[model samples]
Target: MASSSAATRELQKELEGKANDLSKIQKDISKNHQVRKKYTIQLGENELVLKELDLLSEDANVYKLIGPVLVKQDLAEANANVRKRIEYISAELKRLDSTLQDMEEKQNSKKEAIYKLQQRIQSLQAGKAKA
Candidate 1:
């Protein structure tokens, strides 16, 4: 009976730890998803800007906004920068999505472990009570 009680306590401790880990992982996943959404939106906006820039004449005045300054830049340079930014955002989105998938799988596995531990704890407690 004493051994059973000790085992139950240990399992409870492990359960608590797993639960904490699961919570932290879930929060990280949520944050990653939000960041991915932001990047996706930025990619779309950048693509739209690129399209508009393509429509403009080669000699059209293009100014890039620096910190508190509008720096004059060639249309081609500005277009190149926007295209690069779109590419970067798309890549980041892909990376974040893969990371999120891995985290979710870990979270699910932790949940399953927690469920199993809880069941074992319950059975131990029941046996202890009967004894």
Candidate 2:
């Protein structure tokens, strides 16, 4: 009976550890989602800027807001910068998507493990009751 109790304690401890790990994984997934959202917003805004730049005449004035100042910038340079920013944001979104998928997979596996462990504990209790 003492041995059985010890085994139950051990299983409970392991379950607690796994639950903590699962919680951390969930938090990480949430953080990644927030960051991805911010990046997506930035990508959209940059695309809009690029469109506006395209509509501008070749000789039209372009200004970049640096801190409190609007510094004059060449139209071509502004266009290039916006395009590059869009590319970078798109790449980062792709990376986040892959990472999110991996995290979700891990989360699902952990859930399965926890479910199995609960079943094991229940069976052990049922056996003890019968004995």
Candidate 3:
């Protein structure tokens, strides 16, 4: 028969390790979320800039100060940049979600293992009492 104390200690260690790993995963998710948020803000700012430029075009004085704009690609590039930022944010969010799901599954598996160990220890004690 296995030493019950040793088994319990080993199981505890395993659980602790899994908890640490879960913590790391959570931290990674947080970092990813922050990154996504940063990109979102940048996208918003770009859109705002586009809006301001559109407004400026309506004002004769502003257009004169800016002179005849030769940069026809600014709008297109801004749109493309915003699109790229959105895609990056979406991908990062998806990655973080998947990572969280995987970590949750791992945590559940460890908990199941701990439960089984508890049941086995109980059964061993019961058998010893019966003997």
Candidate 4:
């Protein structure tokens, strides 16, 4: 009976630890989702900028704003820079999405384990009370 009580206490401690871990993981997942959303919004804006750049005449004057000064830049060079930026943003978004998916899976597994531990603790407590 003493051993059973000890085991029950150990299990309860483990469950509490796991619950704390699950909470931290959930917070990380939420932060990642927010970052992903921000990236997604930036991607959309980049795409719109790309379209506007495309619509510009080939010989249109393109000036890049640096600080408070506008630096003259060739239209072709500006377009290329924008294209590369868009590609980079797209790749980052893809990576962030993948990370989010993995985190969610981990979070789900932790939740399931927590649930199982709770059930086990309840069973142990009920048996202890009856005894």
lDDT of 2 by residue, 45-97 (tens): 99999999999999999999999999999999999999999999999999999
TM-score of each: 0.97, 0.96, 0.51, 0.92
Ranking by lDDT: 2, 1, 4, 3
In candidate 2, stretches whose alpha carbon ends up further than 4 angstroms from where it belongs are: none
Model 1: per-residue Cα lDDT over 16-48, one tens digit each: 999999999999998998898899889889999
Candidate 4 residue 95 Cα shift, in angstroms, is 0.8
The reply for model 1, stretches above 4 Å from the true place, is none
With a 3 Å backbone cut-off (N, CA, C), the pairs that clash in candidate 1 are: none
lDDT of 3 by residue, 1-131 (tens): 35755665675676567667656756765775687677667657756755665555432332111365533345445445556765676676677668767766776676676567667666766765676
| Model 4 residue 31 lDDT score | 94
- Candidate that beats the other on lDDT, 2 or 4, i.e. the better one: 2
Q: Which has the better lDDT: candidate 1, or candidate 2?
A: 2
How far is 89's C-alpha from truth in model 2 (Å)?
A: 0.2
